[model samples]
Target: MAVDAAPRRTGTGTNQEGVRRHNLATMLRQVHLGGPTSRAELTAAMGLNRSTIGGLVTELTSLGLVTVGSAPAGPGGARGAGRPSPRVALAEAGPYVVAVDLGVDQVVVARVGLGGVVHERVRGPVDPDAEAWQVGAGIAALVRRVVRGAPAGAPLAGIGMSVPGLVRRSDGLVRLAPNLGWVDVSPGSIILAALGVDVPVSLANDADLGALAEHGRGVGVGIDDLIFVSGNVGVGAGVVAGGQRLEGSGGYAGEVGHMVFDPEGRDCHCGSRGCFETEVGAHAIAEAIGCPVDAVGSLGDVLDGYATPPPALHRIGHQLGEGLSGIVNAFNPQVVVLGGYFRALHRLVPGDIAAGVHARTLPAPLESLVLSQPGLGADSILLGAAEMALEPLLADPVAGLQASLAEASSRLAG
Candidate 1:
């Protein structure tokens, strides 16, 4: 779990008791990110006065959302003149969310607590050709397996899913996941139906979530302009500009993979010729490396162990850079993260990609550009999903907790 890079600025809570829910949620978010912060630190970071911060912490304590430690909790653990502010940390037995990263070759389900803690997780292979319902059912099973180990009273929050496709932002409908052979599938609904649970579920494109996680807590922390390029079965990106997502009108903004790389090169699954994905996606990399196409989905680990660079790999690296140039020119991001198999690719050909982007990008965009790998490794999308799932609770803790408790009671009664 990673600490939030930038804390929210809405903590100067109002004096009105009606808005206590907002103040409590704000306080919880602070502890979840800052980790075991003191009353003094919370005041400074959240812009709330000491008494207001104290009152909110007390309420969260009653709800089992956080616990006060006995140790000195001064900033950096230094003691002050007066008695030290109580050390506030996320409760060890607090609520948890289910986070699923559905991939072409693998699926990861995790029980994630506040402060980004992964209490338990399950990961395994999935057939790309499997029906969406079958895959969703299997993922529900994985979710159940992962959450079995949570502390007894830890309530189940919402579920958030990440898929490598164009997900309709408004409805969690997966419009097209060509690599998975899915079209207009509602993965969230299927998983909830499979689990027979009443909790809410949300889904989003994997690349977009990857960028969200990175910008919020990973290597792209504090970077307002970033591009997270995912090299799963396809080549796609998540863009953040001015600290917000750059989703297009149709929620298909970052389809750089389908952008024309070479009009005459290769045919793409999306009925296009010479799309960028056709030249440098997982299959292309596998073919270039002389491996079976079926094994392409899980090639990151295999490709990473190459101590001696293969000629095919070097060529693919050049192709990767050539393809990225167009994206770099258009986004003008401060950071471009190479995720999934691209991480391994970057390790093999950092220079070629850098040179290619530099050669193609306009002078202004290239000046502050940085090419980096995902700090969370394979967990970027997974954690991003967790972040999304926990949004409800973080926004309004009272309502979120009440909903979970009511659902739990109903399950037991039934």
Candidate 2:
């Protein structure tokens, strides 16, 4: 995924060291996103002169974060083209981050490199009702297994986790997760204790991570203002406004599923009656299809038959669009992305959702809104988690790398 543009200098008298670090990060980000760009391309994208680009490239190459090499051949043979431009790209052996995506029924762990590539991954099912510590221990084991499989010379930057709950940004505590039956749990601490490591751990809402993944690497790459709706056992949303995540006062801005929709509808796990989640959540969809709540695989099998969509799937799609209309009216986002089960439902009944949104939303926002499915599929949360873990390193590569290396050394020594 491409990094956001470098922050403009606000005033003169900026610290020279800080400026150099920022410039270095900008160049690395350009390579991370575009892949093996030539010096001229970096100059244009970063708005820096040739000398500055060359110096930054040299520094990054020495630090082992990037490599300067010859660009690939074009459509024509070497005889038909000018001399190839020298290109800069992220090194294959660059540092990586461990990404964890904790869902209600499964946990996914991945080792991801700088350019948003997953080098290795491991995933398995977990009991949703397991004790918090047990869940943490399971995840920690998975993380260790993935870490052990990393390429030999690549340093581990950090760990990032996507939890299906309300996370306290201050301390990486999971405040609430109705589907997982967790409350006031500190999964990060548990995992750290289990692994006995001294690395940074970041925690965020799963839907929020999904939004970040879509914005950075998936379908919403260049679109700044958009909403990512994650529909799993429960529903949630991640909002991006003006190219920034709208995390709100206490990181609770995107809990759109809890909004009261039908006062007379079914009750939700969050203690609300007829909330939006109760209408379109996985359990609700399962009930509509007369299947058990844990019958997700079976549900997919049934949905596979709905290529022409029977009435049931169509109604679900319509309800989803109806719920999304309120969000579109409020946020006026440029796009609305459906993830997880919602993406599956859309595949079954795309036209119904479009019609429902058209019927309910106002013309102004509706005119510009594009409905989309996640490009990263089930891996969006994991990829986004890696991005969060890698941000500090991207901001100040040298310090971040040194700190990570020191931590790794301490772990080995102990």
Candidate 3:
């Protein structure tokens, strides 16, 4: 059990009392990122009074989330010309976040702390063709391995898992995943029951989680409207609009893989032919190049051979772009991010895709559309899952932050 990254300090019990604590915690996190600061700096940044900041800092120091050290004189001088000031910094104590990215062939787990540092990680293999229950067992086993490696008795605040399929997130049940041969499996509950601890678990499509992870800290940081195009066993896209992942009525909003590309093209497992996935997904690339699906490295590697781009790669990129053209024209997003297993167009496809988008879409909609890859690589899904678990906490923070801090305090007190 890893300690909660933002643990709830036990001292604050109720909402009214915890409001000040919540404000202080947020301010301290800001200070940790921005560096040591004075009461004046905290006041301006957090819109809190000097007394409030002082009391909050005291509580934080006692809970080991902040530390006090000597501070230089103010912009002017100390009190009059002889007083010394003290500075507070975020304490590097407590638990951390546990995130797992479960793929058809592998599962990766990571521990992330405050300041967004991935402190530790573990990776293991899974059968791409395994049954849903077996896959759940593998994921559960991998998570336990990661948790046990943490410092003894560390308490975890939450756990998030990314699966390669459509997910009913409210209950952590995976509805469908053709590549993994799974259907109607409740992986979140299985993992939780196996771990024997009650904590929030978030389950989502791997590509969507990957997009969120990258957008949260990587390439799409400042952008509000973006689309993540993931090309793997099957092609999929995760749309982000108004700064949030778009979950359709049933949480299957971005199943771009099923969109028909060519009515007469190769048939897909989803009972569709000439689908975007039929021409651009990993299976298609493997079929085009004459290799087993499992042997293909990644999209980046598949397109590395030709001195000049190969026709097959370009054709695939072009068709993939064509598929995206509709999405761009319809959504008119600020950027489109490419991930998954597309080897040929990690960078080149965006321009080609944008060209198709421009030709099909109104000029105004295509004016500043940018296409790019996630700054974070394959590990994005793991980090994204951790982030999803923390979102509810980040939203309100007061009650949740107190709960996390209190859990950490109880563990420490014991």
Candidate 3 residue-wise lDDT, 1-414, digit = tens: 111223334555545555654675576456534566666677667766689778877866665556777776555664544445677765454445678877666678876654455767888777766666676676666666655555544445567788778988567678998777777888887766655556777788877887787677767877788888776567778888888888887787788888887898988898868888888788776766666667653444655554565555656666777788888887888988887665246554445555555566677877888877677765666777887766654443344455553343233223
Candidate 1 vs candidate 3: which has greater lDDT? 1
Every candidate's lDDT: 0.83, 0.83, 0.68
List model 2 lDDT by residue over 62-83, tens digit each. 9989988787766664433677
What's the lDDT of the predicted structure labeled candidate 2? 0.83
The better-scoring model by lDDT among 2 and 3 is 2
Cα displacement (Å) at residue 389, model 2: 0.8
What TM-score, over all chains together, does every model reach?
A: 0.91, 0.93, 0.81
For the record, the alpha-carbon RMSD of candidate 2 to the native fold, in angstroms, is 2.8
Query: Which ranges in model 3 have alpha carbons more than 4 Å from their true place?
Result: 1-15, 21-42, 60-90, 296-308, 348-351, 395-414
- Give me candidate 1's TM-score against the actual structure: 0.91
lDDT of 1 at 97: 87
Candidate 2 is scored at a TM of 0.93
RMSD of each: 4.0, 2.8, 6.3
